[model samples]
Target: MFSHRVAALRPSPIREILGLVDRPGMVSFAGGLPATDTLPHPRVDLDPTTLQYGPSEGDPALRAVVSENLRGLGIDAPPERVLILSGSQQGIDLVAKLFVDPGTPVAVENPTYLAALQTFRFHGAAFTDLDWTDTPAAPLTYVVPTFANPTGRCATTAERDALARACTDGGVTLFEDDPYRELAYGPCDRTPIAARMRGGSWIYQGSFSKTFAPGLRLGFLAASDDLFPRLVMLKQAVDLHSSSLSQKIVLDAITAGTWPGRLTDLAAFYRRRRDTFDAALHRHFDGHATWSPPDGGLFFWLRLDRPVDTRTLLPEAITRNVAFMPGEEFYAGEPRLGTLRLNFSHADADATERGLRTLADLLTEQ
Candidate 1:
């Protein structure tokens, strides 16, 4: 028979809503997928012949590119330490499978990534949250730190210091999941918590899905040497290796000097869109809504001042042809009824303003 944990995990809420917004003309801010138009053209000329099995670690060129990027982040990731993943999502599962045992204590942000929670839950890890004041024990803690999902809260430099101290003191390992690190649009100043701590104590996972193209499904993890080999073996058992083809393509793209230019352009582009959405949210739904401007990231967490539960509001909003993620889906146990997340990446300038207007009008009438 199959494992019980396999049956216990729920499908990701965002994944479930993906198809719903696929109707011919619907505007989507649901998926965390990056804007495809921003990715650089593939530079690696695929031979169509070398499309076979890749190295268990990753492609040499890709590894080199990743290693260079890691150095920029202050992590001394050798090529051997990098294991290319299908995406950062798969890296989450691999970590969970290797580090999380059934009933083992795992720490997570109060409002964390739904998929990471699902991955750990499927691996049968028991989760405890890092709350506003609660200090956890020697557990494995998971955090987004920068532009946290559904909260738009970037961990402050002070919070980063405190988190590092907690992890070091509690003898806990920190999983820094930073997919939206490069999308900063506002005043952002915080170093990675992992960078602040001792080596091997913090496991950092990053993805090209947000910065580059998601279909490439490219992600890399930087950890201490102790954790790298086991994750590589776990990855080898799972998917053997992330596609060599994708790796080469990304490598070529990065080395060609397009990735950096595109990154700056992408950040500026998203920043404008974010500012527009923030203004629209204020102009249309100012008093009744509450949200912090996301300094860098795709989604903005919004809390409605009234009793209008997002779960309750979704059906009506959908009928009226507007939709957003309910805040509760990001929670571990009970969903936050009045909270919701609005993704500003997918929508263009006009669509963003229009979508926010529709939601605001609906709320005003309600």
Candidate 2:
């Protein structure tokens, strides 16, 4: 028999959709996967120790690299404050394990990252809606402020400041999940909420999965003095340490000074995909549906003009050799029938166009 938590859990909708998208000739806009061709394959001269067991806290060199990256985001994080995780997803799990108790109040964006909602649910976290402009009085709140997954909406500077101030004054722990911060389109503001907060009221999670390669399974968590030690201990209990070889490779690649240029190229590549997807949406469904052009990130969250349930339409889309994420899966509360998320990063321009057109035709027929 499974535990109650395990029993309550549902399979990830995105993961389930991935299976459907793998069919022959399927044009998938389902997963938020980085373009495989854009992934970095740097040749690093590995130290002998890289193959051995690493420190539970993570590789010191990699932590330092992560610290510097945080500094670029205006967060004054030291290497000692960072804890490496197998992925940002693991970081979420650890946070939920440490902070959330059964029925503990947790605030999240209305349509937050689906996996995060799942993780919090495992720890029995009671979800509340988060408004960036006004902070709710919950013990912990999670946000993907910049180019949020599924929705791809970025918060304004004032909103970031307000969130930071709320956490500082209210003693709420602001969980800033920022995998797509660097994937912005142009001169968008990306001031981290941690920068505006005083004291230990925020935890920031970043991943190389978006910037480098997800297969590496590398991500870092920067916590305030109060929470860093507990997270380190939790990580140690979860997995003695993350992969040593992966950390070494990431460290060498970032230190080689080529990573920044790669990120630039990545942005340009995704921008073109975003444009292509947007054009298709406008051309096919401009009057039939409503959606915002994301400033950056991989997805476009569209709301159908008519009352069409996306969950019921997914199998039909797959039958048409196209796939996307129905938006009902992203919400922490009630499901939204008309909404769905389309990923533009993994699919190339032609594939994206074909997929969107197929989806549009399906909607038209409906």
Candidate 3:
């Protein structure tokens, strides 16, 4: 027995496949898990407030630190507008609570984040493409403009400007998710859409999950005046507030002088992994699949030049002790077959190369 809302919920495809990943000697590139070796351990100096109940809007000092980081990236965020979340995942859930009514229209990018899709589906939102112009403006437009997951495609600055202008002109709210900016091989390729928006409603979400550690479970969104208060209200209903100890840890890392250097070191490390994977891809699957190399982020998205469905490829891959994400699960509507996502962040270079060669051999048989 369950509520009507429960009927709408579906498990995340990534998490669903992760159960198969924990098998002995399985080299999983399936989940969006960050490299464990790269995570930072900031000095922990806790205060009594960390043990006490804190504001649902988040700790003021941590919010200020998050606000300042956003400002440096060109978003016009102040500490006042920033509502700290348990993670950006919670941010998505709170957003679903605030704006998504049953049958409400929501526009999301094709092959978008599966967790976001699952959350909105739980709220009964009908999904559409980002260009939801056939009807009146969709209430929300969600995207990860910089180093997007699954695909790892960064939007061009021109494209970002056009999107900002269109959303501002159409009276729609833009939700720009930017978690992978700090992991860029070079300078971040695109300016934040929030910074470029011309007097329009928007939300800019950022997280410590990618660059730092997901266990911290700390992230935030900067919203406009109209949306921030209600988001805060929903957040209060959900968890009252995020972990005060997590807030202290991240705030310490950011405020301390070591964070920037750590980011630089991380970017270079991910870049090496990306290069290793890219080389193996070329050596093995080059003609069998087509893909654009991601400048940053965890995955390499591929459109296989064959007739096989990736959903059918999983069981065989499991037997081979290799794992990846089938791309169809990322779609809101019917999926485009023959596509998949491979993660380059978790395994070491030699393991990554061997895994890719095996994946390539699998693709070649079809």
Per-model TM-score versus the true fold: 0.93, 0.97, 0.95
* Cα lDDT over the full model 3: 0.85
Ten residues in sequence with the least summed lDDT for candidate 2 = 129-138
- Output the TM-score of candidate 3: 0.95
Worst 10 residues of 3 by lDDT: 130-139
lDDT of 2 by residue, 259-307 (tens): 7898888898888888888898898889778998899888999998976
- Give the Å shift of residue 214 in candidate 3: 0.8
Number of the top TM-score candidate:
2
Q: By lDDT, highest first, what's the ranking?
A: 2, 3, 1
**Model 3 over residues 1-366: C-alpha lDDT tens digits?**
889998756666678778876677778889877888997757787778688999999999999988887888788789999999999999888888888999998888898898888998999999988753332258888888888877898887777877888888888888888888787875555688889876878888988998888988999999877788898999989999999999888888887788888888888889988888888889888788899888878889999987568989887987898999999888989999999999889888877877888888887775
Highest lDDT: which candidate? 2
| Model 2 TM-score relative to the real fold | 0.97
Between candidates 1 and 3, the TM-score winner: 3
Model 1: how far residue 39 lies from native, Å:
3.9
Tens-digit per-residue lDDT, 1-366, candidate 1: 887776786677787677777675566667775655665566466687559876888887788778887777777677777778898998898888878888888888878898888888787777787852345653688889888887888877777878877777767777888888888777665567777776436678898888877888989887876778788889889988888878877777777756678778999988887888888888877887788888889988888898567787777777766668888878877766778888887877787777788888878888
Which of the predicted structures, 2 or 3, would earn the higher lDDT when compared with the native? 2
Alpha-carbon deviation at 8 in model 3, angstroms:
3.6
